[model samples]
Target: MTDREKIQQILQGISKTALPAQPSESLFDAGVLDSFSLVDLVAGIEQAFGIKIPDSDLNPRQFDSIEYIEKYLSSHR
Candidate 1:
């Protein structure tokens, strides 16, 4: 799956809901994710992408949306 697709699936798995049709939608504002869910997202992304997300570098802005998360992963990878 593409990064966006993987992200959507991860978000859906974390939130137990459908993802927005638009990849730009804010998962946080849309209530699909929250602080607690962000934690799950981090773990999911790390495992799925095989990249380390240092706990000390946790930043909500890096994961505000699918676009942001994808970009962050690209840079990190």
Candidate 2:
């Protein structure tokens, strides 16, 4: 599957929230996600995308927005 689809799945699995059709949506800013949710999100992304999300890349910026996460996964893929 494509990165966007994988990301939507990851977000759905982690937050149990309906994912927006657009990829540029701000998951955190929109209150759809929060700091406590990052732990599950990180794990989901790592497993779903088949990419290792190192501790260094686990900062808020990386998870601040869906676009950011998608970009990171795209680079890794």
Query: Which regions in candidate 1 have their CA more than 4 angstroms from the true location?
Result: none
lDDT of each: 0.86, 0.76
If candidate 2 were superposed on the true structure by all CA atoms, what would the RMSD be? 1.7
Candidate RMSDs in Å, in order, are 1.2, 1.7
Over the stretch 1-77, how does candidate 2's per-residue lDDT look in tens digits? 87777777777777766666566777876666877887888888878767788788777877767788878877777
Q: What is residue 49's positional error in candidate 1, in angstroms?
A: 0.7
Worst 10 residues of 2 by lDDT: 16-25
Quote the lDDT for 32 in model 1: 84
Tell me how candidate 2 scores on lDDT.
0.76
Candidate 1 global lDDT = 0.86
- Identify the leading candidate in terms of TM-score: 1
